[model samples]
Target: MKSNLAYLHSYKQRLAFISVSVAIIALSIYFNFFQKTENPEFSKLTFSETKTEILPLNIAKFNPNTLSTEEWKALGFSEKQVATILKYKEIVGGAFTSKNQLKKCYAISEEKFSQLEAYILLTDEAGKKQNFKQNKWVKKELIISGKFNPDLYSEADWVKMGFSERQAAGILKYKNYLGGSFVSKEKFKECYMINEENYAKMSPFLLLPSKTPADFNPYKKNYAKEKRIIKYQNFDPNLLDFEAWKKLGFSDKQVQNILNYKERFLKGSFKTLDDVSRCYMISPEKFEEMKPFIKLNPDNFAVNNVVNSNVEMPKQKTDFAKIDLNKITFQQLKEFGFSDRAAASYLAFRKKLGGFSTKDQILKTYNIDKELTQKLIQMSTLSPLIAEK
Candidate 1:
């Protein structure tokens, strides 16, 4: 009987423990299941509601690079404008640091930048802020030597100087290169033809529109000869249209002269009535003089053939330039002998973060197979100038 009581007491103790566990679990459920959910400290809002309430006229004060395409459209930017900015970024480097610096951006308008200045973050990789800055100084002038022709100059008095004809002609030619009509005093000193002595002598009251004579052309006509026609006549000069010149009793030499002059002097046949009227033969002064006699039977006009004669075959640039792996496009990566799959992997890895800055920067982007990165390190691409022109 004593043993039976001991066993029964142990059994009751075990049951009580199990009962207590169940009661604790039931109370936990009652508190948790019946309780109200707590409110979150902050909540996300829909873009439309946020824009309507938050934007106001201050929409102009945002940074465009950070905006979504929808947000860009809200500010009156077209898809093309956005695309231009992206393409310019790819070609010329990335976005401007601030709204004012956005002047370097190709397509964003002044009005649009004003609208977008408010939202710009202008942060670098380290999270440091950026601001607008400009370089205000002018570039220093350059000096170069060249040759020229004197008859091309407006004035003839330049011949009085003891300078060689070639030297004077070269000075004039240099002026032409700069798009200046006449030689500059500052430029003359730049060429060193006018030393301190000559510069002092010539710097006083200048008389220009002075004539500088041209070298006699071996090709120029002898105006003294009857064979040398002093003036041109209004006429069609095609050998194909000999009858037209013959009707005016034009000599064979005269006709030959006219045809040769047409080939040598004109760029092309009449593109329009105005173009035909510009020709020396058909010029306004001459066209009006010859309008009564002018005739046109040929339906087809000649194209500008002189351009073909003068065209220099472009020297084929050697493809000696190496591609920079860090900066290269996916297409460029493939060109460097990366298989399409490997190239695609590199792009995907870079796209997740930003692109690599150096060949070593590739290691920071995840999922790049270690073996592949190691293999790429064995070789490197160089800039075009570094490899060859």
Candidate 2:
């Protein structure tokens, strides 16, 4: 009876072992082949072939004007299809004038257009007309029917000539910086606030000379024979008074003009040597002569100050603590001396990437400079938790 019991226990152990082995084999087969084959996307396709497969579409109401490149792709459009739509919009002017215009694109077939028709939103005709009128490039009717000197036109006068209040103020401000008058039509045209179309319409009525006189030397009292004596010494252009500028060979009028520019246009200080160089009254030759003597304070040479300036300034040395790239804020970036535009751009790119996994990825941000890139790399740290995700 004891022998019979022993044999039964031994047979049960062997059966149990075989059952476990079979279960393991079945699981391995499922994982290695059956599991992958169950999903059509993973089955029987090369990498290149998989890439050609269409991504699922997400349809929603969208304005073509505000829709981004990625948003277009999300709406079931192929890369070529998205590019064609964008190109058509660009060719016709920067935006689609109407929903019908977008529907007419070659990439957008009638069937596709039908699918998107209910979701398309565009500006009304009245709104478009208002936008067209507000465009600076659009030619306005001539309010001043006869010849008039733009130099003498007051802010109100400029408004009467069809310029907006803001544009009129800009013109007047620029005119004040140029010694209360425009020397020539070409110089007047150089105002950044005025577009080519507006200038062309106003050109025929402007009474100023078409070009400045070759002999007209703005820095000197007499261009014929008088040579003003100048004393050169190390000086900060930002700190110079009217007397100091006159002492540096500038005429009294030129000195007053420079002071006016420094106080008004530059908000009472020169941020860079380039700002001093750009004074409208300072002739190029005069600036070159005094360039060596100008010394700006070292503290004024911040990264933001020199980014747009032609003058090169050394970046201030800083030891930044490592920061998680995924968690950095726009205000934090601004504290590092980034412009509003650059900071916004960095944030937008980071959002598009989900989150950065490495320091090198920050380099791909639009408008980021090499110096900023190096600083970013030095200060970046990826969160381990984020990396796993």
Instruction: Give each model a TM-score.
Output: 0.18, 0.24
- TM value for model 1: 0.18
TM-score of 2: 0.24
For candidate 2, give the lDDT of residue 308.
Answer: 26
Residue pairs with backbone atoms closer than 3 Å in model 2 (clashes) = none
Q: How well does candidate 2 score on lDDT at residue 360? A: 73
Worst 10 residues of 1 by lDDT: 138-147
Clashes of each: 23, 0
Error of 1 at 37 (Å): 80
How would you encode candidate 1's per-residue C-alpha lDDT over 167-285 as one tens digit per residue? 55566555544344333344445544445543433433233333333542222322223224323354432223544554544565444433433343343343334444533223243
Prediction 1 global C-alpha lDDT: 0.45
Tens-digit lDDT string for candidate 2 (33-121): 88777785775666543233333465555667666789888888889999998898788776665666677799987777777767766
